[model samples]
Target: MKIATYNVNGVNGRLPVLLRWLEEEQPDIVCLQELKAAQDNFPEGAIRNLGYDVVWHGQKSWNGVALLSRVGKIHETRRGLPNDPDPSQSRYLEAAVNGVLIACLYLPNGNPRPGPKFDYKLVWFDTLIDHAATLAASGAPVVLAGDFNVMPAERDVYKPQRWVDDALFAPEVRAAFFRLLDQGWTDALRTIHPDETIYTFFDYFRNAFARNAGLRIDHFLLSPALKDRLVDAQVDRQVRGWEKTSDHAPVWIVLADR
Candidate 1:
């Protein structure tokens, strides 16, 4: 099975681009972030028309997450992080699709730090870490995929020094990410392509994409149960070249069947 994660930016405005990609790649399961639509505004029909049954948690004009599956029924497990610091934002959604538990999230950007937003980001991340430990202990196959908004290491960012003051590259945030991995979740892309300079997002400013200046913030963390099943992982960078596309391109992993 092939599972993919993409931060669409805006589900409504990017519907065309999304449809085109879905038609072309046809991943068995997809996790979407930054829907930027209200619950009633989600393009449910549009997504379903492509044969994907979807479950989403949406908040108007901001963070949102969804899971789409065509290979199996999506049994929704939860919406929003348990005890999220800011539950008002629809940032987390979880479901069991094709027997694998998938957690999709749109972590806060926490820009312009030294403020409440940044503080909340840390709190929210800690909550996720706590919950992830439980999921890891369960020993069920799980995939945590989404736009984490953090560059976990120097290799994951284009210019490490330039982003040192930024929230995404903050030392505390990067350490938290490593803490999650300590629970036995494998970073799929890094594990498969170990030393390769892989990236999933590029800003529209300064011709970032054209210059190949990007950040590998979006990720897929696979639980121990599915570690050996991982066959391949990659970023569909070409998708970012599409007209009016999201800063993030689709990232996917192929898995061996049971």
Candidate 2:
């Protein structure tokens, strides 16, 4: 099975770009972030026409998440992170497709750090860590995939010093990411190509893509049950060069059939 994750930025505005990629890639399952549209505006029919059954959680002009399956029904497991005292944003969506539990998330960017947004990012990371621990213990095949928004290590960023003051590269955020990995979830791309300088996102400014000034923020964390099945993991870097494409390109993993 092939599973992919992409942050579309705005599904409605980028429908054409998204459709073209989907048609070309044909992944069995896809996790999408940043729909930037309300539930009613999800354009379900258009996606359905492409032979995908999708489940999505959407909010207007902001964060959203969705899971699309081309081979089978998507049995929605949850819409948002559990126990969120003030649940408002649509940043998470979980579903079961082809017996694999997929948790798609669009983590807070926490920009202009040392502020409420940064604090919330940490709190949100805590919630995810707690829940992910339980999922790791369940022994079921699970994939935590999406735009994590945090650069886990110096190697994951283009110029580590340049982003020292940024929340994505902050020490605290990186520690939280490591804590998640401690729960036995394998970082799919890193596990497959540890020394490679691979990246999934590039800023539109300063010709970042042309210079290969990118970061590996989008990720896929695989549970132990799925680790051995992982055959390959990669980023579709060329997608970032496409016209009107999202800053993020698709990151994917291929697994052997059970």
| Whole-structure CA lDDT of model 1 | 0.94
Q: Write the per-residue lDDT of candidate 1 for residues 168-200, one digit (tens) a residue.
A: 998889999999999999999999989999899
Counted clashes in each candidate structure: 0, 0
TM-score of each: 0.99, 0.99
Span of ten consecutive residues with least summed lDDT in model 1: 110-119
The TM-score between candidate 2 and the true structure equals 0.99
Model 2 misplaced stretches (Cα beyond 4 Å) = none
- What does the lDDT read for residue 144 in candidate 1? 95
Worst 10 residues of 2 by lDDT: 78-87
lDDT of each: 0.94, 0.94
